[model samples]
Target chain A: MMATKKRTVEVELSTSGIDSQGRPTRVPLVVDEQGRPVPMEPTLTLEPDMKDEHMLINIGPQHPATHGVLRLVLELDGETVVRCVPHIGYLHCGFEKIGEYRQYNQIIPWTDREDYLNSIGNNVAFALGAERLFGIEITERCKVLRVIAMELSRIISHLVWAGTTSIDIGAFTPFLWMFQERENVYNLLEGWVGARLTTTATRVGGMAADIPAGWTDGLSNFLRTFPRTLDEVDRILTRNAIWVGRTVGLGVMTAEEATNHGLSGAMIRASGVDYDVRKDFPYLDYETYDFDVPVGTAGDVYDRYLVRLEEMRQSVRILEQALARLPDGPVNIDDPRVILPPKSKAMSGIESMIHHFKLVMEGPRPPVGECYVAVESPKGEKGYYMVSDGTSKPVRWRIRPPSFVNLSAIPRMVEGHLLADVIAINASIDIVMGEIDR
Target chain B: MTNFSAAPVGSRAPRDVVPASPRDVPRLGGPQNPSADALREQFGDVVPRVDVCWGETTVLIDATRVLDVVRWLHDDEGQSYDYLVDITAVEYRDMERPIEMVWHLRSLPYRRFLRLKAEMQKDQPLVVSSIWPVYKGADWLERECWDMFGIRFEGHPDLRRILMWEDYKEGFPLRKDFPLRGRFSRSEQLSQALAANPEARYSMEELSIVDAFQDLPADVRERLAGGEQPGE
Candidate 1:
């Protein structure tokens, strides 16, 4: 018997609306040469049995779907993924190695490049860790300002995640909408720090600059209009059939597994674990800010999406509270060791000039101690572990990159899922390769 | 199966658990984490040095019993340090100082954070028990620690180079002795980069996956055979 067979399928055409002649505007029926209706059937070809064989496929170090220099070698039996081995470090510049050579304040710029999406947040986190190492408590005004910076950066990161994930799942309109809101946040950041992407806005003891005069007005404007865009994207994607069908029930990790895998931020929270670092290990006075951490029961791709969307709204609430409780005081601590003198004072007074010169040249030294300060970054728990040797430079400055840890579970998440679902699952992880390979 | 709805929320600190903000925390020692005391009681000899710095407790334990202490910390109901935050090695500036391996663990249920350290002297082989048995997240963290610091974590499955390529020969980049510039000179590094074969990107684990090597073109297969042998 032949391996292939032919079959005929019937075509049914619907009638179009009536024409000017009042007749149904229907297309002419498909007919054969013998004056009979043609059965338009496609041929089906059968091949030899090959269930035992598995195919190996490679994705990126260049592909966009893998998201920035992430190479995945996947083992597949037909369409189902049997195994996945992720190769990274294509963008690794050894930021940790470089951190050892730079001064504490000088290292803030390096933090900006590691997680480019959450650059300000990383700067804030490094400042917090370095401040702890130095035993310096920042002023109340600086605290509130850092909180605003963090939440704004969080919104920027989640917006990029939402936009990129939507595009990955074949929804284009929401990507544009999400990116528009992200641009608004970036504009606000640019107004504050004068840089859009790499806003190294934090110093060791305080901000690089206080939110410029009337800057809270821009933030107020953002807080006012951001939710409208959030709601628009939510309305489009939350119940859209295609979005739900593609995202839901993929990359399911239970609470125990998520916690054991060291997942954090939205990744662990989506697994129904309400362990927000801001709440559990409260820093920047996050406990005083009244906001609910949205927890999800399913712990799948859909839950992660919902958790992230809700987090942006919660960030808005926190930003509003931070703005309301914005204290009026000095931004930097009243210490000459970590903070520099005013530019005019440095040029005018000898004592101020000596202080500024010493600080700028030698760099403020921290006592011999180590502090691991973790903040709940948009992706996960971004931490800066610092070790001081009573010297201007750090003995070791380790960035506990959350994306690296979250991406580690890709092999576990993608195995046993279909090849198409792998893209959705990887997108759900929301990895920044710069952070992962740093 | 875990109850999906009634999953364990945050920590078991209290019904109204509120973590202290950084501003309120003392500059130096205030209160030691209770787990530090508990670890001493559980493993007296292994838990040698316990210190509190910047309000966070650091417990220095013997490198040999790291896995045991970590497993007990994870399994024990009272001191449930369920989350492994990070694994890193710190080589101090002083050449004579022993390299310290740090493990940052967090107890989500109890809202407690603890640091565990194990020092490996330069004379001894940098070997320590892996905590992968206690936490699956330790897999990549251990591999990365090995990659950067050259600390070999015993019993770790697939503890290979993570941030660097498999055949990277520049020595551990994070080690104090390693120069700021890489081991190879600039021209030599550029020449090596230019001479690298593109086909060697795939590891033996990837190439051996179900007929991949056999499927390669004969000339490519000959090239690979002439190069560094797979599984070397």
Candidate 2:
């Protein structure tokens, strides 16, 4: 087939406003009577004039301000954010899927990694859920030990949040001061669990081991010195004019908004919601402890910072009370089905040896049921929903990660605020990527 | 005596009730609260079963009217569950209706907690309207349920995957049938792509920058782009 000649059409270009150099002629800047430069109107356009077009900008998958691999696509008009779409799962490791195949006690290490900064709290939350499922009431000593460990972890997690938030907002000195205290807390943890960061410190029924000799002495010393250091950092950042200016009126969430969004811990308390799991649910004998839950009126970054600082103080109070009431008993439960027997007994008797072997190999078989338990973790309510199937492993192990839920409110918090305020708002949330993407 | 009936699976014998400690703040609401009774009366047929397990009340409702029940619980003046604590799904592959969706709702004012669950067919895992309109926190949670268990929230505004990537096409990883080891391996996928495009510029082995240009001259990048072997 012969090819027909290509049809061509002559298209006229709009050159009326063109200069001799073939560039669009510059429109003179419009000015008010006072001589301030005003924006010029468009001379040529195909589409109708919209006042402001939104430009989409991506922040973090690697950004320092995000505190993790959280990627947020921000739609901006000028410098104010119009909308924010968060893209997560860059750090997803299928923790829940992996828990399905692992035995009950074997999943403690997984919880440790969920919130690396607050591993002990995560461990305690998971253990409490499992114990509730098995209907095993722990001993008084175990309860006191768990309370101490959880409060210590809460202090450490909050210190990290304080340091990171201060650093994000351009105050570097508080970070160093707070990290010094964090290092001390980590040393205290290392003494208890033999690990620093990911301390799988607690078991299903109790602790991995009882607190060693002199552990409380060091904790007491920390309790004394930590408050002074916190007060110093508080003086440095809480009243600094720049800190107040950047955070005071930014990202204010009301009580109703916070409750509807399911925020927990300081996120909700800062919004004036007086709900604390330690106080309300009263597990682990928290009902006996004498400490106040701090609530704030204005739910802004500055308010969150204040609430977290007050919570650390309250944690110190709980630590002091728990230390005073430290009981003398077996840390682990007395049930053979839950805790492994002593090596001496196992070696002396065949039945005990078989029990030990089965306990170590197959793990504890919880009853077929489900239970949901939540604790006041450093970030928020770190909850675990475990469904047992009369087997060694859980049929479904669901982690209600507080960071995942709290981070969902970032878009709502950052809308209509300046782009720079995103850092302050995100820092206020203080999310851990491991938990959010787990 | 092998007494299996002595202690049931999920039951605990009543212990001595500890008196309220001196430091115990009186609960905001009374223990004789009638929220459970109110729920039972309001949604009579919708909630077929109400179980008081381990001192926590859980209402088992039909999947068709889950939205109605939750809305009633949320909007009802006496039993307002203002806070939506958690939402998740559990898979029981052997059961007739294999998927169970669990929701934990808490009322901040009353200091009360309630768990609501609805069962869905394993093959058709569809739930009624999304609770995002009522609770904004359900946005990511509903997406997570859909990602992990393939449970569809019918009226969700954005129903895409949250924890998994957009291009992920494997079976839902949280389902019982999904293998412990994932269905597709990243290394295998890379190798297959390299095998399919052998004549293309880069192979799987050379995808890394350090491996692709180790100890090569500055001009080697240009030479390799011209289809010339760098080492030669």
Candidate 3:
């Protein structure tokens, strides 16, 4: 009725909601009966400092140094860190929850996805956790094969860091050279485990399948040339003044501070802690191997960079030894309680078929006890704490992801440095988001 | 005296236990003698009793004695589980005492380790002296236990959900009682069903694809209508 003086006004506030399937559904500002905030894709809001005591810089959940979905709320003063609050779980895949429902063996696929960069290491860690808790010994052939795979994984992980870090720090040439080697390792893994980045081949008590023939000899050739390739790259960067300037003394942390921040693997070792799980908590024939744990002089980004580079050479050394000591034995444990009877046993025998069915549907139980097993992962010490209530599924299967812990040092490492240094620091730490947020 | 081989995951049956590589030297505690009795005697105030079973030693200590115990193990001046290889928790919700905190520790100098079990009532389950202070790696390990099983490490600098999203509070998913099937967002299941059956009819389409086009926004309607002759 009143067309006199009218003006159209629109207030837009977009929000998200879940559809019937939990898929994120968005709404344009829907209000409830009570007029409260409805849940949406998890978001963070900085509480405006009521006191105005300090300035805050939000560093991630998207920033490059975070390596993944990690968000760090850093309180800083003139390039120096006053406080750092690390918030995680952006990439939380509910892996442990997934493991709870899955049969012990069914979880191998998920483990590969957690530490996607080092599937071999993940497989080995999980396999060892199962074996230690169940007292099932892996066969010699399987152990050596696993060793070959894991050492290769360690090398691949370092190569990725080298490439990614080089790109992060303004050097593009090393990225290509390093990725060339990573691609070689990936192709070899695909042949061995049927997947490139995520190999779900390592099984409890043994591997999921036997090596696809000539793997040992094939990997040996790769390992032989790997050193020369690394050496060629090293000649350019290891002692390069520019490389040292960006890394050395940047993100400096002492052994005490590193340990305090829960640094491990190269992060702790680079700080002069001298800890390597392969040497500390031997797993899967590691006791018989020969290699050195390279230690860093400073706990700084440069030291971490050095530690990982040296560690790659050491992993190659271990690979050489594994090749020479390859042994022949059953790959999977013979026990029906753990490893399933071969298909040959199942097709004809009713009992074997039933056993297979039960194993698939119900799964085997671990003894009523607890075991914590830590193995050297490419990132650091990837440990699994498995506890059984004597049930088919584990009462608890927890993974101590090295990337998650190592990345915690980011705020400390980059507190006073330029934002650009964050990428350098992230590369130095070698944080793999899948593993970190797992 | 429990010697997990002081063997770690592999058991060589004596004859096969070859000398460890430098890489393997620190395997399970760097070759130091981490006997339960010796640990008990060393931290008489911390370790009340130690039991060696299955070649692995489990140490029993009063909840209050943990700090003193770890002080002895980590910085006891002689033994340093300096490298925190790993830290984890155990939930014995069914035990007579219903204990929940068990810390596995290793001393690199001696190349040995022991599992410390601190029994506490579930309602007020608490323990002191987490290995986090000594080993940087234990920070997340302790946090994981806290997140999954509701175990707490008193002195951890940052203790919160490490895996589950910050807003999640449905019950610890790792607990024995948490159902595997349920607790998923309804939308999650719906989407999964939809993904599996991509051809399933949508509500608008069920109204008739021709009629559904009328419900589209003017812009989207224009784009789709452009795909065909209206009369056809």
Best by TM-score: 1
Please write out the lDDT profile of model 2 over residues A1-438, one tens digit for every residue: 221222222233443556566755545344545665543445523232324655567798999999889998888787899999999999999999899889888899999998999998898889998888787888889999999989999999999999999999999999999999999999999999899998998888788988899899999999999988877887787767788888988898999999999999889888887777887666887878988787877888888888888888889999999999999989999888888888899999998898899999999988777777888899998889888878989989999999899999999999999999999999999899999998
**Ranking, DockQ, top scorer first:** 1, 2, 3
Pick the winner on TM-score between candidates 2 and 3: 2
User: 1 or 3, which is superior by lDDT?
Assistant: 1
Those runs of model 3 whose alpha carbons end farther than 4 Å from true positions after fitting are A1-55, B1-35, B42-49, B85-87, B92-99, B125-144, B151-171, B181-232
Better of 1 and 3 by DockQ: 1
Give the fraction of native contacts in model 2: 0.35
The per-candidate TM-score of the B chain, in the order shown, comes to 0.81, 0.66, 0.60
Q: How would you encode candidate 1's per-residue C-alpha lDDT over A124-181 as one tens digit per residue?
A: 9999999999888899999999999999999999999999999999999989998888
DockQ of 3: 0.12
Q: Individual DockQ of the candidates?
A: 0.33, 0.17, 0.12
- Candidate no. 2 TM-score: 0.82
Residue runs of model 2 more than 4 Å from their true location after superposition: A1-51, B1-33, B93-97, B190-232
| Chain A TM-score by candidate, in order | 0.91, 0.88, 0.84
Point to the candidate with the largest DockQ: 1
